[model samples]
Every structure is written in structure tokens, then in C-alpha cells.
Target: MDLPALPKPITVDLSRAALIVVDMQNDFCAEGGWLHSIGVDLSPLASAIEALETLVPAVRSAEVPIIWLNWGNRPDQANIPPGLARVYDPDGRGEGIGATMANGSKVLTKGSWGAELISALTAAPNDLHVDKYRMSGFWDTALDSILRNLRVDTLFLSGINSDQCVYSTLTDAASLGYDVVLVDGASATTSPQYCHEATLYNTRQCYGFSTTARDLQTAVSAYPDTCKERS
Candidate 1:
């Protein structure tokens, strides 16, 4: 199927493609979550949820696999390096990853509410889930292995913090030789407008193509009969 994307339209085999949603978990998108507890605005991330609500079902209908990649850290924080830890808690405060929130959920810890997907998004039973410790989902995660097992060569990327996690994962996907497409509406960042703009610019210029969720939905809808069952 040919997808309408910026810089140029690209062709993709639906059976060999998958959608990767990064960092759309509670700690990033939900109110009273980690980023919210840090006083970051939650409004910008809402657009991503809104877009995914429609796009996810559409892509699923097209028989494309859905992979939810989220930050699910170990409770012990043993694997977390000091540099990464400092980025979150510069003062060595207890508010960073693994810290218990007011509601009693440990921030971004595995099996914690903060690391789970937000209530608004529903992950199907057969969909894949990967726990990532770093901004790039491919870093020290089973994401690459799962994609290989799925026989997916093309990846459609979405989710929160477009300028950070989303971009990081997208670039790594490219480096790993996967065809990448950044679904614009389905991804967003809490950073300034310029950061989001630069992400789009760099994605088109350096990493991969960029397109709206609506365009991808349309592309999938157009070739409904052409989609084959996933392996």
C-alpha cells in the first residue's frame, strides 16, 4: 500500500508493517502521573491520545500488528545509570523514576499504575507489549526481537513526547534498517512548539517520512482487501 507522507509518498506491505506506540503510559500522559506531578502541562499530550483512538482501530482492521512500547523500570533501579537518573532527578530527590507517588503508585515501576497504559487507550489481547528503560525503545529491550519475530520491516511510530522518546525510537528504527513513518497527529510532545517542529523537520530530512494519522488511516482503508493475515 502506498502511504501519503511528507517529503514523498512511500509504499509499504501491510503484512510486513507494524505500529509502535511509545511512552503513552500513565506516567507521561495521565494527570497526577510523573510528568504531571512535575508540573508539566498535560494538554499537548491529549492530541496524541485523540489521534491514536482512531488510528489504532483503523490499523488493526488492516491486519497490522500494534506494539505498545512504554517505560517500565525495575523497582530496584539497579540497571538505571547515574547519568540517566540525574536527568530525571538532578538533586537526587525522591521524585524521579521508582519514587512512590501520592496515590501510592511507584513512578514508572513495572506493574505499577504509572507504567501502565492510560485508561483512554485500549490494548488488544493479541497486541505486543515491550518495557523499555530508556528513551529509545530499542535500547536494551525486546522490541527489536519482537519486530523481527513479527517479520515487520516497516514501522509506524506514535505516542507522547515527539521530540524525545518518539524521536529516539524512530531514529533507532532507521538505524536498525526498518522503514519508518512518523504519524504526526498520533504523536506529540510537552516541549515548546519549536521542538515539535524541529522533530518533524529532522524526521523528514534525516530519519524517515512523516504523515498524519488520517492519511495512514486512509491508505489502509483504501486497500482493505489487500491486507494479509499477520504471521
Candidate 2:
């Protein structure tokens, strides 16, 4: 795969890089999930899931840590405040804390299948999982601590809702002085096409570089040493 060159060269150290996948949960991707029950389209997520199915293993082959950043609220929903609730349901559809969707999965509530990662994606034994209450994984989460402890400085971000959760996390990572790359085609948006394009534009112009998963896979495969594969 021919890699897309950035405007300028951006050096990414494989040893210190991490790949983070955001919000690829049943609630967001599966047909019977909460979002689907609420009339949100799950079609866009298919490509992202497909890319990760292959690209994640390529990343592991390169010895880069794969972190799953997902929305998994507490069962009590105590961390969710009025603002977040309103954003989730502006029309007041009674989809607040503890409210179950038509599919019987409570949105964002922990211990619910809806909050779990979609069945198609599995976590490797060495992979990391971080539950987030907000759009940015760093907000009220141990994401930063985990990255710091692992000495990770470069991040490749891909997943659902490119305009929201993905962008939010990318921005936060860049602000924290981490090198961020938004893996294009490995992310999706239920919103209009413009929303996805806008995210790529903004992320590239303001936050980080953007490239496809194929490009990333090629880059990872070029690493000089044979990194230890995860068991």
C-alpha cells in the first residue's frame, strides 16, 4: 500500500506508539443496539470494524499496544450529569439514566451488553481497556495515566463517531503533547458525509495528521526489528 505523505514528515516511534479504538460498542454498532433502537444508523461503522479486524493484528505484529476506549457508564449513572443527559436526549425521550432502549439495552450503563464492545471485535490478552464517562477518554478516566505508565508518546486513533468522540479524544491527546494520527477509513460517522470530512479537516489542520489504515499497516510492517507478537 502506498502511504500518503503528510505535508511534512512526522516521525512516529513504533516502540512508543499506541493505537486507540473508540466507541465500537454494541450500542453504537450492532443492529439491536441502543443507537439502532433510537433510529441512529449503524451502517457507517462497518468499514471501521473491518479495518480494525485486520489493522489491529498488524499493529500487534508491530508490538504497539491496542487500547479500546469505550463508553461504559456506571450502572447507577451517578457520573452522568444534567448536561450530558440533555446532550444525549435533547427531545426528552426519557432516555436518561437507567432508561432502557427498545432493544432492552440501557445506553452507556455498565454491565449492559449495549455498553460492551461489539461482538465482532475481541480484545487480545495484552490489549488495554478504558471505560470513559465522557467523549474524551482522558476526562475522568485513567487513560492518561495508562499512556504515561507505558511511556507511550505517539497515538493512532480510529473508531466510531469521528466528529465527536474520536475528535474529542484526538484533541485531548494533542493538547497533552502526544503525537496523534487519525487513521482515515478506519473511522466512521453516522452523521452526514460532511461531518466526517469536517472532522478529518479539523483534525489535520489543528490537531494531527490523517491517513488510512492501509498506510498505517504498511508503515508498521516496515519496522526494522521483529517485535514480539502478543500471545
Candidate 3:
């Protein structure tokens, strides 16, 4: 498939960097998933997933920790307040707390198919996993703790819904003084094309930087390895 031209990626310090792939979940991409069941096209998601299939391994080879930042929330979803709750199923079309599609895939509850990562992206055993309740993984989660522990100062970001969770986390990361990079080719949204464009614009102009997978590889290749052993 012919992919669109992505913005040039910025070179990052490999030693202090990590690739944070956000919310590539079944509910948003798979055919019987929540978004697919609701009629949203999964093409954008497929593109990101495809990009990561190549990017994940290369980053891992660099010993850059790959954090599978997903929405592994409480089964009750008690952390989700009503204001943010409406976004999932505002129309009440059999899509709410505990709702499931015809395929027996639970909608948004934790431990359900909808809340799990899509099968496309592989989750390695050593990969850091964090279950988040909100769009921004930094909010009320162990994200900061994990990053600090890993000695990560630069964050390489990709994943689904570029305009939402990806955007939110990037903003916070920038505010907190962590150098942020958005891999546009690996970060997509089913929202309007303009939304994706706006995200790229805001990310570059406000948060940190925008980039492509090829450029990212160039950046990763620049840094020399300190300790070859994976932590």
C-alpha cells in the first residue's frame, strides 16, 4: 500500500529514549471491536499498526524500552467519571458500561477485548506495561515512575487516536520537561484527516517534534550503545 509522506523525524538520544506506543487496542481497530462495530473505518489504525510492526523491533534492538501503554483499567471503570464517560457511548446504542458487541467482545471494561491491545502489535515479555484510566497515561498512573526508573528523558511516541490520547500525553510530557517526539506515520486517528493534521501541527509547534519512522531510525543509529545488555 502507498503510504503518505511523513514529516522528517528528529534525531534523539537512544540511551535516554523510549518508544511509547499508545492505545493500539482491539476496540478501535479489529472488525468486531467497538469502533469497528460503531461504523468507524479502521484504515488509519491499520496504517499505524503496520508502521509499528517494523518500528518496534528496531527500537528494541537499540535496547530502547518499548512501553505498551494501554487502557488496562479497573473492571468497574469506577475511575471514569461521568464527564469523560459520555465519549464512549453517548447515544446509549447498546454501548456503555458492560456493553458488548454481537461478537461477544466487551465494550470498554478492563480485561475485555475492547480494552485489550490489538493482536497486531506484539507485546514482548520485557516490555513495560501500564494500565491507564485516562487519555493521558501520565495522569494518575505509574508512567512517570516507570520513565524515571528507566532514566528516560526523551520519549518517542506512536499509536492510535493521534488527536486524543497521543496528543494529551505528548502535551504533558513536554510540560514536564521531557523531550517528546511524535512519529506521525506510526500515530494515526480515525477522526477527520484535518484532526490528524492539526495534531501534527500542535505537536510540532507546541509540544516537542514530529517525525517519520525512517528519520527515527536515523536518529536511533546516531547514538552509541553504552551497555549492550538489556535492562
What is the C-alpha lDDT profile of model 3 across 87-198, one tens digit per residue? 6679755565456678776666677878887777888899998887788989999999999988889898899789999999989999888988888789999999899999
Task: Please report the candidate that would top lDDT against the real structure.
Answer: 1
TM-score, prediction 2: 0.93
lDDT of 1 by residue, 1-231 (tens): 887898998888999999999888898899889888988888988878998988998898888999999998998999998777765677988778888899999988999999999998999998999999998999999899999988899999999789999999999999999989999999999999889899999999998899998999888878757456665
lDDT of 3 at 229: 46
**In model 1, where is the ten-residue run with the lowest total lDDT?**
222-231
TM-score of each: 0.96, 0.93, 0.89
lDDT of each: 0.89, 0.84, 0.79
Best by TM-score: 1
Rank by TM-score, highest first.
1, 2, 3
Error of 3 at 214 (Å): 2.1
Candidate 2 residue spans exceeding 4 A from truth: 1-5, 226-231
Candidate 2 lDDT over residue span 121-211, tens digit each: 8889999999999889999999999999988988999998999999999999999999888998899899998999999888878887888
Q: Candidate 2: lDDT over CA atoms?
A: 0.84
In model 1, the runs with Cα more than 4 Å from the true position are: none
